[model samples]
Target: MKKLILIIGLASAALTFNSCERDITSLNEDPKHPTVVPSGVLFASAEHALLDQVLSASVNRNITRFFTQQWAETVYVDESNYNMTARPIPRNHYNRMMASASAVINSPGVLSALRDARKFLEDEGVGAVKKNNNIAMIELVNVYAWANLVDTYGDIPYFGALKATAENPGNAEIPYDDAKTIYLDLIKRIDAAVAMINISEPGYSNDLIYKGDMDKWKKMGNSLKFRLAVTLADVEPALAKTYAEAAFNAGLFTDKSDNFGLQTFPSGLLSNPVYQDVIQSGRNDFLPSDVLVNFMNSKSDPRRDVWFTKVAGLYVGGSYGDENTFSDFSHFTNAISGENAQGFLLDYSEIMFLKTEAAARGFSVGGTATDLYSDAIKASMTEYGINDTTATAYIAANPFDAVNWKKSIGEQAWVAMFNKGFQAWNFTRRLDFPVFTNPAGSLVEGVPVRMFYSDQEYLLNATYVKAAAQKIGGDKVTTKIFWDKF
Candidate 1:
């Protein structure tokens, strides 16, 4: 009887151990739950929340750097307002951002987080947790995505954000939203965010963008609204005027201090990704453009010195191409090993230029065109250490003639946006200013209007691509966005 009892005890112990092993194995097997919290947050943020704001900030800044290089001038991708060395493969910010956004957008878990925001708001009540904070974040995310999509593809999925679920299903294969529809939706989302915000409560915490500052978020929202309205000026002038007036009444970014931007860290893995890549890898691949260099030189603009370094009395920069080819001209061929390199989303100078353009167009946004234009110019010069005398002199010599003002606006904005590709690309598309003559040997056949749908989109979302093509009139390089009106 004693032997039988001991056998039974041992059997029970073995069963318990097996059960524990099963639980441990299951934890490792689960693919849906990400291992890291910050990674999860970043994934969610990239797709449904505010990833592009950060990603584009980095990527656009780099593009500006590239434009300052030789290729933009020789090929005419951007008119060289600044003389540069050679062009590099337009750094892949769009690819990286798109990949991150796509991973979250296509994932079921991330989608649930986005959908849960609505429920959390409902349960907590709009005012209880300052519901507008959540709404504002969501609105900002959607707007960023929309801007990126349209800027890259002209038209894309706008209304079907988190709404496209199993029930009340939207066409995953939905057609592209017209530019007009997209702009209208952007305004509506901004309005909703503004209305939902209750500045009385303690603000949000995990908000990586504004960090619980409802007032600043409101300012950003208003500024974004103004930006969208201005983008539509060529396509729908009447509506644009109304929205611009509303933005002005709401109060736009008042100063550089009020500018919406991301502050990158000096070190740690999360330090500005661009700075990390460029510094560590010795991969400074972009060169300044000749068109820009000539323009700056003509005005005796002092910013040139701050932006580019002189090698043997010639402003030199790296080139974009295969590793073998790039090695020929680029000086820094190893990882970047310095500090102080960082990224910015939007700056005071950019906001100033927006206002300058609005004033130039007589859009009823208070401020004289010349004053705003001069302010924008000076702000840019200050960034590059061009003294006040030079800045003032450049402004005086450049003046604000309608024809010349348009050219100056494009050139100045382009210079300010140096290293930021999407902004330059967006500005080029909307205004077609700076009238850059294309380089003789661009790999891209012509100035590409939008990026080709990612390989993943081509394979997995082919149906959606086909439908989008039908709506946008062929998903090719030439298909213009609604605002393009080409």
Candidate 2:
């Protein structure tokens, strides 16, 4: 009887297993949620990731504005005082610039997403012309991301960056590459990307910057190349002149219409980063610095009205690095504080300023230094809705000081780049203008020249990180970047 019962139980178990085993894979698949994302989606993700790194004012992510003394902290003054270890700022930026495919699939980074998007296009057998345009866009974005990384932290992991593949999983421990070498290569990459572009054909449909407009993409590519060339003007003047001239000759940002950004972002989860920091965060933690406000106040800059709200009918700013009350000083105007403020990666005003600098350096970039300088300020004024007459009068009042071009151009560029901190920092560093002293109670001896390498690198890639630190003459905040040779 026991044997018979055992047989019956075994038979029953087998019957149940058979019923569940036949082609149940389809049942496990979710039709509503896709495992593979579209290439356009990946491209768009890359765009946002890049923008966040450059545009965010979050202390944990970006503090360039504070370093350059454009904005001051109200409550948490650690960042304002150049505290690197307190937050994972360098790590955040480094990871965003280059991350693994598996990691990017979860949290998209600039290079990783672009890598994935390129792979997707190839796998799907996209048409040749369309694919070329798409690849051009991808290459341009990649060049920008790489250039920004080099600018932020000199001698980064470039050659082996994003090289993890199925056959070579051991490629994760990448080696560091020289910043100047990387910059030179990046300029070449930009040229190649521009060459690949077929402007007549459609490109990325999910593009956040240009929205499938290859013409605008082409302009941005040249503009970006021009920017890189100008950045190397101090260190590699001949190469800089050659590239800058070529870039301008190819094409550049014609006006604000050619601006590269998502100007109109919807509120809620996808609200602008500036709005997130200033308003949506439910904290009044930032105020314009006296360094900026006093300068603008002295000039009687018209954009002050568009950018800030007056405190007691006067534009007062918080002292740099000192703790101050939020309501006691001027706050961002509704135009900036509101949900749908502009967030640009590159703009005409910036390109014009670059042209101004290029011309000042005697590089053939079309116009005279004074004329380009005037155009740049006019572009800034036009962007803020100030009339052409006001811009003309303002230009007249503060004419370009070609004798002290660095001071004149640098100060105005700093003002024009109010919320655009990274670019402002670059201009300040390259031109060495407006003279920044260390913030009160600063962590380091002087203002940071370059951000320290990510702390995680020392742990994971100890040997490489140590080697890089040694090569760049220590990873201190005061360590100047390769292109920042004064």
Instruction: Report every candidate's CA lDDT.
Output: 0.53, 0.82
lDDT of 1 by residue, 309-414 (tens): 5556654443232122332232321121133443445556666777778777778877787788888888877755578888898889878666666676877787
Q: Where does candidate 2 clash, by residue pair?
A: none
Best by lDDT: 2
Over the stretch 219-262, how does candidate 2's per-residue lDDT look in tens digits?
99999999999999999999999999999999999988898887
Candidate 2 lDDT at 463 equals: 87
**For model 1, what is the error of residue 387's alpha carbon versus the real structure, in angstroms, after optimal superposition?**
4.7
Question: So what's the TM-score on candidate 2?
Answer: 0.91
Model 2 clash tally, residue pairs: 0
Q: Per-residue error at 282 for model 1, in Å? A: 3.6
Model 1 has a clash total of: 44
